[model samples]
Target: MTETVAEAVARRRQYIAGGTMSINRAIGPAKLFVRAKGAYIWDAEGNAYIDYHAGFAPYLFGHGDKDIDDAVIAAIGSGASLIGAGTMPWEAEIAEMLVEAVPGLEQIQLTSTGSEAVSYALRLARAATGRDTVVVMQGGYNGWSDYVSYNLMDPGDVVADHREGDEYPLRVTTAGIPKVIDTTVRVIEYNDLAAAERVLARGDVAALILEPVLQNVGVVKPLPGYLEGLRELCDRYGTVLIFDEVKTGFRHALGGYQAIAGVRPDLCTFGKAVANGYPMGVVGGRREIMALCNDPDPGRRVIIAGTYNGHPVNVAAARASLLRLKARERDVYSELERLGARMQAGIEAIFARRNYPTTFVRQGSAFALYFMDHAPRNWRDIALHNDNERDLAYRRAMIEAGVFHFPAATKQSSISLAHTDDDIDRTLALTEDVVRTLG
Candidate 1:
């Protein structure tokens, strides 16, 4: 007489396309999650799991954080949300906060989701450069808009025997995308400076956009000169460079990856942890480029409009989150670093003691476990070296042992501010169990 998690998932699958709202639910058991609170989740079957997925890397302060939720509720009760007016007053405050905190971003425009931000970034680029082709990374995901739908390496990954300068055939992630997008977008492998230069030499690229760190595939860090090289090539080709930091915007530091890499893009997009689980995104860049969004000349001004672009409640949440970051910059960042280091050390120690051929890669609060001897340089390396089956095995075992991740293996995991030392220790213990069981 009682419905199980599996049963509920099955029933929902009949109506909900793909059985889940996001593509993530299709990876693991399609269970119905009932609720979540501060680094933990409960499924329909009443199983509790320590949540590290954090709703796909948005929960910096963790789920149900009172400071953020209270602000959201207060805004709504005060009639700040769902404002279909021209613009809310608090929009400027949040925008000012972002420009002040993040370096190399002089101005910004708001969007409700990361995908929309990326789309507008491309539009700005095309309008500024008067070019059609936009360059993208082979494995990097910049939202699911038609311009970026090609070459998504999840669920439909190719064998990927791609060589430098070798044209990897484009495969659209979904149907209904115009086939002509293949001509408008050029795909290049991330971290390959030679490939980047070779592609950009054509002098027809409107933009070269990618994640500063190729995060979709297990937090792949850029090689020492890779990011700097990209910046140079973008300048050489007059291509607008846009860094999509939807995942890394607020995790490692308040300034995003550019602060760490010290190489700035022409424009950058922010989402995920910006508002700490609130639906918001931002497209920011140098003053000259970003001003194109509001250029006085009609021919130059790019159209960027959304009804909920700066919802007052979400803006309030962003303000609170950014203020917390600013006030406790040292303590919050230091603690996050400590937690990330602690988790990475524990996991590495396990692999070392167990004599398993595994590698660990981490960036501040974000981390990944690869079933390979060496860290991956890019997606091609991931395809050739990373042991996906073994990686999936460990991830499933950890989930079964009460640790929650993105479900699919390629996603990078994060440790939120809500995660205490005890939480890390328990997670490490569970991780050890999973590793040992896999053996």
Candidate 2:
């Protein structure tokens, strides 16, 4: 007999810590999905919803994409899953593709997860600069590692004392992070050039890592000259600038957002859509920095070892995903923009007709709708103005109306390549109805 949702959730918690692998998944009502295809997922109870969450924004070409799956199948059929020895041909092929696609990346090493890649990036920066301190944006998230896991969505009170153009006190997201670790991580506000310079001026910072577009706080964009300003500051301070592009890498553009922003960092890390949801992470950037991973001087080498770093299947998937994006670069990105605009416009109209104040922000296929009237410039802007309860209510209502948006405030809604004009229309119609009831 098939287990019910409750039974399944219970079974999960019975063995897994916190009843789930990621505690964030435990938020909201218990939901157990049984299957997914292009544009949609079916819950165990057989309800279908157009998936805007896209499994946390990884399904660029869409869930179960045929070409990518075929590549994985081919790789598995070749009986070369894991050599556990010397490097293979698929590794070089994928690495070459990555180097060609990303604008600022000169050398790269693979890891099994984005968190691992981020960990390596931090290590490389510290090793290269011979400094222990790292500066991170207050609201930016760069994986779950201890080095960069502070101040993600902290409580308002925790950040209430924070002043504009200043840094927030260390608010670690989880416990078990060493207290000594707090001294090494410095927090600063996003889009604040003065505050960044103040922090970096201390002259002890090893790296300044951040997402080009702050997706962690619902797509807060960099103010004009903000990224360039940070670039200049890092150059002046001798700090290694690292852009964590795990979310905005392949989903926005093949070269990552750095390519579009025209500001290159000393290092960049990528995952998520890099393999279209396959487990792959990349840490790469300027050759001099990346060379630390295998430095001729043993003391300087930043060791990045994983038995499954470049698994053959995942490499095949990454190669296939990148090739498809490269081949249809024009068509794919244009279509994504069209769909994003359509979704944004329709939602804007629905809220406008309701006279409900809302702000819709988009960057290519990724977008967010905040209950605030104006676009937020930073996480504090969002924390002060955006309506958390209403935003969560709207997302829950939409989920019930057959549109899945991850039922969380300030989280982004993604649009996949498989999402069609009809899907957009249906979602809009559903949005109109959902908004009507929200009153």
* Best candidate (score: TM-score): 2
Clashes of 2: 0
Off by over 4 Å in 1: 154-160, 165-167
Candidate whose lDDT is highest: 2
Expressed as tens digits, the lDDT of each residue in 242-295 for candidate 1 is 899999898888999899899988999998999999999999798888888778
Q: What is the C-alpha lDDT of each candidate?
A: 0.86, 0.90
Count clashing residue pairs per candidate.
Answer: 0, 0
lDDT of 2 at 321: 94
How many angstroms is residue 424 displaced in model 1 relative to the true structure, after the best TM-score fit? 0.7
